[model samples]
Target: MQEAFSQTKNASAVKNNYDRVAWFYDPLSRIVFRNAQIQAQQALIPYIPEHANILIAGGGTGGILEAIADQYPAGLRITYVEISEKMIRKAEKRFTGKNTVTFVHSAIEDYAAKSHFDVVITAFLFDNFTQEKADRIFQKLDKLLQPDGKWLFTDFHIDKKSSRSWKTWLLKSMYLFFKFFSEVEASQLPDTTSLFKKAGYHAIFTAFWYRKFIHSSIYQKP
Candidate 1:
């Protein structure tokens, strides 16, 4: 099937590229995005309930995990999945003795969940693919969450009407840069808000940063 082929191809691209960049991801991200990366993850932490089962798909370099451990040390169960083995290794090193976290070195499409989770966190992950591929992946992720669960999402967004022209240009430039260096498949950012709404999710909390060039939203399945 076309869907299966797309999944395989995308997974390959992600794994190959992320493996190459795993060692330098943290410093690069901090330099580029500064505190915005940490702020995005922190925006969702207050929404996560105690004793919750959480799925963190494409959680790069374990910054979010570090934040969670610092905030809620012992009561949550988390499954952290990443396509790059080296990236997962870095994450494991970050939390060497954490008991409630399980790291899975696998692509998002290949990760099979034994049970549905209460919360799913995806940070700067979905932008790597074309719109169609992102849509399919979002649908698959929707099925992996429990009914009434929350999905914490953070990524770049370009608002045509309210956002300035330079922001659009900058986003395009960023995409082109990533496409060349990171093997990213998408040339433009996908409309994640519309895709999530199509999957029967309603945004419970939304925040914007860097003049609305980036957005962090918490969507709940009702």
Candidate 2:
């Protein structure tokens, strides 16, 4: 994945776009998606072990870090990775004196993991890629997990059966907004559930927030 990300055509563009919005990301994100975001994080908290080695890929602005720290148990080693330097700096501010959390400023594809992590968290991260890229990236992420490890994922999903027309409009509007400001590669949400199943990951738990527009699930790697 590191190699693939290094070769990505829009890596720098994406990084720059996020950097441009780092200052406003926290506040805007809170106003727009805080409820669902918090709910998703809370759902995954119970699955994380006390002494686990965890990877937080594309954890923008460190909202997840703050949540984990509030209820964090001792002996857990967390490596938080974000591609935007400014975003990571904000995260760094939240954990100023904490030794258990290590921050890495790099794209997930370029990050070098010394060993497989017991748990991997990718909250609201996968929505930025196209289906094909998301599939490749998921494969790479799966390789970074321990054999029995679980992946805690949260992102937007547009369910045709369950979603209303207005919900679809809202999702599209949000995507267009991000695409202009963040250079988001995908104009629509990827079919993540299908990709996960194809990769041999089974959902151990799942939840929906905001009328099922936002989906959260924990998939275990076999």
Model 2: per-residue Cα lDDT over 185-218, one tens digit each: 8877788888778878889999988777778899
- The residue pairs in collision within model 2 are 2-109
Error of 2 at 200 (Å): 2.2
Judged by whole-model lDDT over C-alpha atoms, candidate 2 comes out at: 0.77
The Cα error of candidate 2 at residue 25, in Å, is 1.8
The whole-model lDDT of each prediction reads 0.78, 0.77
- lDDT (tens digit, per residue) of candidate 1 on 24-97: 87787778778887787787888998888999998878888878877777778888888776677777767423
Candidate 2 has its poorest 10 consecutive residues by lDDT at 1-10
**RMSD to true structure for each model, in Å:** 5.2, 4.2
